[model samples]
Every structure is written in structure tokens, then in C-alpha cells.
Target: MAKKVKVTDACQGCTLCTMTCPSVFAMNADNLAEAIVAEIPEGEEAAVEEAAANCPAGAIEIE
Candidate 1:
């Protein structure tokens, strides 16, 4: 099953995740990157992990 990742306080709104994976990350109204996984199809875990790994602020958490 696909898991969900969330953006937290550590986020600096750098948008690195969004650039790395536009399929799963988006810039919210607050200008912070939010991980929207509800629409994510299966077999995309690695991409999510890449986003988490690329997040410089350590704000992305996979649940």
C-alpha cells in the first residue's frame, strides 16, 4: 500500500520537493510544500522517499 507523507514546521518553503516530484508535492497557499498523497497511485513509494531524502529542511515525514 502507498503511505502518506506530511510537511511540518521544519519546512522552509524551499520547494525542492515540489521540483523533485511534482506528481506528489505542491506549494500550498502558505507557500509551503505539501505532500498530497490521496491521489497517488501504487508503486510510487520510491519517488516519495526521494522527495523526503531531498528535503533539506527535514520536514517531510512518511507515514
Candidate 2:
């Protein structure tokens, strides 16, 4: 199945996700990183997973 990505409340406004996957993640007005889209785009699963794994706050969620 396709992967779904989102940022949890634990986000510390870190830009790691954005830096890791600019296409799938971006910083919102609150400075927290959020998923640019609900569903991971084709071939971008690895990048999203990496972002989630690298997130220091463990805010990134991939389901």
C-alpha cells in the first residue's frame, strides 16, 4: 500500500524533514514541519522514510 505521512504535535519546528524531502515536506507558519501532501508521491517513499527517521523530535509519521 502507499504510504501516508504527517507531522505530529511533537514537532519542535525543526526543518529536518523539509531539508530531507523538500518535495514531500515543508515548514508551516508555526515553523513546524508538515507534510506537503497526505500521500507520498511515487518513488518518494524512501525520502519520506528517511525524513521520519532523521527527525530529532520524532514528529514525522509515516503510515
Candidate 3:
């Protein structure tokens, strides 16, 4: 199973995660990266990790 991810305080409202993994991540009304679990599939773990790795602020956390 894929783990849940949280956006941390380090978030700078950067859209990198959203752009990198649109299925799991999106930009909120405030332009912050929000995880949309309904859209993310269980097998996309690598993609999610890639998005997290690409985040400049290190905001995405998997648990």
C-alpha cells in the first residue's frame, strides 16, 4: 500500500510537486501543494517520491 503524505511548514507554495505528480498533488486555492488521494493510485509510489524529491522546500512527507 502507498503511504500518506503531508505538506510541511517548509512549503513555499511552489507548484513543482503538483506539476510533477498531478494525479496525487494539486495546487490549492492559495496555490499550495495539496495531496488529492482520490486521484492517486497505489502503484505510483515512485512518482510520488520523485515529486517529493523535486520539492525545493522539502515539504512533502510520506508516512
Candidate 4:
């Protein structure tokens, strides 16, 4: 099955997710990182997972 990603309220406005998975994440107007794609793109799951793993605020959520 495919994966989905989201940025939680705990985001610390850090760009790590954007830098780690630019294809799937981006910075919104609030400066917090957000999942840019509605769904995780093919072969990008690893990066998404890594972003979540590396997020200092532990704000990234994957389902």
C-alpha cells in the first residue's frame, strides 16, 4: 500500500524536512514544514521516513 505524510502542530519551523525530502515537503506561510504532496510519491518513502526520524520537534507524521 502507498503511504501518506503530514506535519503536526509540533513543527518547529525547521527546514529539515524540506531539505531532507524536498519532493514531498515544503515550508508553508507559517514557516513550518508541511507535506507538500497529498500522498507520498513513489520511491520517496525512505526520505519521508528519514525526515520524520530527524525532525527535532517530532512533528512529522506518516500513515
TM-score of each: 0.82, 0.93, 0.84, 0.94
The better-scoring model by lDDT among 1 and 2 is: 2
What's the lDDT for residue 7 in model 4?
A: 94
* Candidate 2 total steric clashes: 0
Best by lDDT: 4
Q: Could you give candidate 4's per-residue lDDT for residues 1-63 as a string of tens digits?
A: 788899999999979999999999999998988888978999999999999999999999999
In model 3, the runs with Cα more than 4 Å from the true position are 38-40
Per residue, candidate 1 scores C-alpha lDDT tens digits across 1-63 of: 667678888899998889888888899999998877664557667877888998889998888
Clash-forming residue pairs, model 1:
none
**Tens-place lDDT digits, model 3, residues 16-49:** 8888888888888887877888334777888899
Q: State each model's CA lDDT, in order.
A: 0.82, 0.90, 0.82, 0.92
All models, RMSD in angstroms: 1.7, 0.8, 2.0, 0.7
Candidate number that wins on TM-score, 1 or 4: 4
Local distance difference test, candidate 2? 0.90
